[model samples]
Target: MNNIITIRFSALLILLVAALVTACKKGDNNALTPDLGTRVAGKYTYSELKTGGKTYPASDTNLKGTITLTRQTPTTVAIQLAIVHKATNEAFADDAAEDVDVVEAASGTIELHYNGDTIAKINGSKISIEGEDDAGTVFTLFATK
Candidate 1:
C-alpha cells in the first residue's frame, strides 16, 4: 500500500510540473501589441493607384477619397472607406466591420491579411495595398497620412 501511494504521488508531481512548464512558456517575440495597432491607426489619403501597367492618381471622382484605419484588436484592424453620400462614415463591411489581420513581419514593417491571404503592407507611415475588386479589377493603392 505504501509503495502504490508513493508512485501515484510521483506521477502526479511530474504531470503538474509538465503542465506548469508548458503554461509558463513564452510566445513569439514578434507578437504585436495593442498599442502598436493604436499607433498605426488613423486617416490616410490615396497617394496613387496602379493597375494593368497604368499609374493614375487616386481622387474622389475616380476612387476612394480616403481611408481610415481603426484598431480592432492587437492583431487586427478595421479599414473603413469614406462614403461620398453617407451622412456619417462607416466600415468597409456591409454588415459588420471585417477586421484585417496585422502581422509584424519585422520592426517597423507590418503585413495585412484578409481571408488568410496577404493583401497589404505598412512600412513607416505609408500603406501599400494590392488586391482585386468585385469587378475583378486588380489594383494597388499607396496611401499615407
Candidate 2:
C-alpha cells in the first residue's frame, strides 16, 4: 500500500511540474496586453508629406524625416520630430514637438491627440500626423516603422 501511494504521488507531482513549466513562458506573454505607451514607442521614417497643394514624396531630396517616439505614460507618448520638408520650407520648431495623449481607436489603431485635436495615429507599423503652421497651411506627415 505504501509503495502504491508513493508511486501515485510521484506521478502526480511530475504532472503538476510539467503543467507549470508549460504554463509559464520565458518572455513576454502574448496573452497579456501591453500598455498604450509601450505599444506605440518606436522610430518611424517619413513616407511622405502633403501640403500647399503638393505632395512631397520621400524620394524628394529634402523630404527625408524621422521621428522617435518614447513612452511617457500609459496613455501618453512623447514625440521627437526631426524633419525638413523643403517643398514648403516648413521646419518643425523646437517647441512644436510635444507629448500627446493616445487612445486605442481599434484593435491595431491608436490615435494621438493634442489640445483636444486628433493630430496623429499609430496603425501597426505606420504612423501619420496632421497639423497646420502659423500661416494655416495644413500638412500631413506619414511614416512607418
Q: Please report the candidate that would top lDDT against the real structure.
A: 2
- The clash tally of candidate 1 reads 0
| Residue range 1-145, candidate 1, lDDT tens digits | 9999999999999999999998995877656544556766888777777788887765532555566788988778888655232334333222224588888886668887888888668888888877666688887777887
What is candidate 2's lDDT per residue for 10-129, written digit by digit as tens?
999999999999998698676488898888888888887788878777786466668788888888888887776557757762234456898999576899888898878888888888
Residue 47 lDDT (model 2): 84
Q: Give me the candidate number with maximum TM-score.
A: 2
**What lDDT is reached at residue 52 by model 1?**
82
What residue runs in model 1 are displaced by over 4 Å at the alpha carbon? 1-34, 59-61, 83-96, 106-108, 133-135
Q: Name every residue pair that clashes in candidate 1.
A: none
Residue 116's lDDT in candidate 1: 85
Error of 2 at 52 (Å): 7.0
Q: How many residue pairs clash (N, CA or C atoms closer than 3 angstroms) in each of the candidate models, in the order given? A: 0, 0
| Over 4 Å off, model 2 | 1-31, 51-56, 85-99, 133-136
Worst 10 residues of 2 by lDDT: 89-98
Where's the lowest-lDDT run of ten residues in candidate 1? 87-96
Alpha carbon RMSD to native, model 1: 11.4
> lDDT scores for all predictions?
0.71, 0.80
